[model samples]
Target: GHHNVQRLSTVYTSMGMSNADRGAPLWKEKRDTWASVCDDCHSPRFARENLQAMDEACKDAGMKYTETFKVAENLMLHGMGEPMPKDLAPDWSGQHIWS
Candidate 1:
């Protein structure tokens, strides 16, 4: 059994937690504080709602969802310029979404 929930950074990143940033996103000890920035870095919501939103955006961007890239690549590709909700990321992922 792996117990590390208090480390919201781990739950948020979906990758694992980091104590010293370690080149990863910064995460505080409070969950409420993180709620604001969670979607920006990465999280379960990203894989869930955010990606779905990106899919729609990709379609709107006149781009097709081809089976050429991994889930991450496709999500990133589709997220570009895709109007994101203010709560999630107003203009955060736009760069990664394009690049």
Candidate 2:
């Protein structure tokens, strides 16, 4: 079917993506970000050991190690892949916290 073909091709393309080409280095980059947010929002320090342990736990539970994180749609839609927007400022006041 069309869906299976699409999924297969997606898997192939994903397999071909180089480490640098991926938006974020999943385990290192995103997990660190999560650790920072967690420590800030909860108890004490964000230990490297804990993060590594958590990563190990996730892997044991059939989680992925690395993958592409490219925001393709938003990149195309919001002119990120096109010309830069004028006067780009951080609008923290906006109620819609999509970012």
Which predicted model would earn the best lDDT?
1
RMSD values, in order shown? 15.2, 17.9
Q: In model 1, which runs have C-alpha deviations exceeding 4 angstroms?
A: 1-43, 63-99
Model 1 C-alpha RMSD to native: 15.2
Model 2 lDDT, residue 23, Cα? 27
TM-score of each prediction: 0.20, 0.27
lDDT per model vs. reference: 0.41, 0.40
Please report the candidate that would top TM-score against the real structure.
2
Error of 1 at 62 (Å): 1.0
Span of 10 residues, lowest total lDDT, candidate 1: 15-24
How much is 89 displaced in model 2, in angstroms? Answer: 50
**Across residues 1-99, which tens digit of lDDT does each residue of candidate 2 receive?**
122223322321322212232224543554444445456445435445665564455444322213212454467677877633656633333412311
Q: Count steric clashes of candidate 2.
A: 0
Error of 1 at 64 (Å): 11
lDDT of 2: 0.40
